[model samples]
Target chain A: MLDKKLLEVLTSPPDAAVAIVTQGKDGPHVVNSWNSYAQITEDDKILFPAGRMNETEQNIQADNRVKITISNREVQGKSIKGTGFLVIGTAEFAAEGADYDTIKAKFPWARAALAIKVESAEQTL
Target chain B: MLDKKLLEVLTSPPDAAVAIVTQGKDGPHVVNSWNSYAQITEDDKILFPAGRMNETEQNIQADNRVKITISNREVQGKSIKGTGFLVIGTAEFAAEGADYDTIKAKFPWARAALAIKVESAEQTL
Candidate 1:
């Protein structure tokens, strides 16, 4: 299951950019998505609409491993006023299927759905 | 030079978390920090106080190349309300010296300084 605090951060007003990190051939690559842009599936998988994640898609083709960081300044942390979480997972982009259908419904501009099979979601604030 | 808009976002009220991504042996690793915590140096380098980035420090030692994403919902973008940037850079941790001193002064709890020599800071949103 996803961390409850992470769910709170995602549902609340976003105070920070969500980061998606992937390993490229040259080095590590990073991209930004809004906290509210992420959706959690019934099975607890995380999904994001991919409008133009060309490089990220290419990287995932070679290696499915990915890391994502999401945070919210409005959420309470274990010892602080704000909180964040680090999500380690493997991702695959789908243009057709249930995941893609889910994302396309909410984000009409989405060309693909980035589905993440999370290994862990750890609070890191 | 850093993007002027990015500087504006960094200096203004933070609306999001900044993500620092590094390549680890296992996969891409991600950590979060607040946008307001970043400081621009006279030489145009970016600095962050390292509270306990043990894994990040280890990754930097093996490979200095890094990718950082920072964004602000309050900043105006070229074609939207919010703005974001992708920073490609190399990083080094400093325990002592002018760079370390700069970070230590502002973040008293910082054990080391994470200094980034930016190759590019491109506006992504």
Candidate 2:
């Protein structure tokens, strides 16, 4: 299940880059987004605008598994001032769906929507 | 060579999470670190204090390839206000070496040092 702390992290003011990790032919490829850019759907799927995630899209086509890390310095951790989470999930890119429309409405540059169905979110901080 | 812009991002301020991605048997695993915690060595290698990166250490043993993303909102982007970088590199953990000692001296909580030798750093945003 997705942790509530993750929702807090996303809503909080941007403090750190959100990292999206996907497997490539040679190795793991990484892309970045900000906390302000993430939108959580009613079913708990996370939506991120895809402006130029060409390599990320290609990787997901070959393998749908994705890993993401999000953090916020303003949020309280288990025992510290900052908090973060490691999200293990599966993802797909949608160019013409409700998800794409939702993201496109928020981010004008979005050509597609990177939708992540989270399997588990572990609070790392 | 590592892009000088990455250095600027690291030194700017704590505005976004730094993500460290390593490949696991199941899939790619992601971890989080802050920008203020990274230390660049004289040789241009980046070192991070490892408090409990056991999974990250294990993944690197199987495959040394690592992907890192660091971002800073304060840094000027190519055509935007924010700037970020995708770092494709090789990494290893040091428990007792010059690298370990360097990180340990700065971060008392660190039991090991996660050192990354940069292969390339591309400015993404």
Candidate 2 residue pairs in backbone clash: A15-B15, A15-B16, A16-B15, A16-B16, A16-B17, A17-B16, A17-B17
- Across A1-125, the per-residue lDDT of candidate 1 in tens digits comes to 78788899888985467898888888888888888889899988899999999999999999998888889988999898888888889999999999999999999999999999999888997
Best TM-score goes to which candidate?
Answer: 1
Per-prediction share of native contacts kept: 0.85, 0.75
- Residue B33 lDDT in candidate 2: 87
Model 2 regions lying over 4 Å from their true place = none
The residue-by-residue lDDT of candidate 1 on B1-125, one tens digit each, is 67789898787775568888888988777887888889899999999999999999999999998888888988899988789888889999999999999999999999999999999989998
Assess the local accuracy of residue B23 in candidate 2 as a C-alpha lDDT between 0 and 100.
Answer: 85
lDDT of 2 at A62: 98
lDDT of candidate model 1 versus the reference = 0.88
Please list the C-alpha lDDT of all candidates, in the order they appear: 0.88, 0.88
Tens digit of per-residue lDDT, candidate 2, span A1-125: 35778899988775467899898887788898888899898889999999899999999999999888889988999998889888889999999988998999999899999999999888987
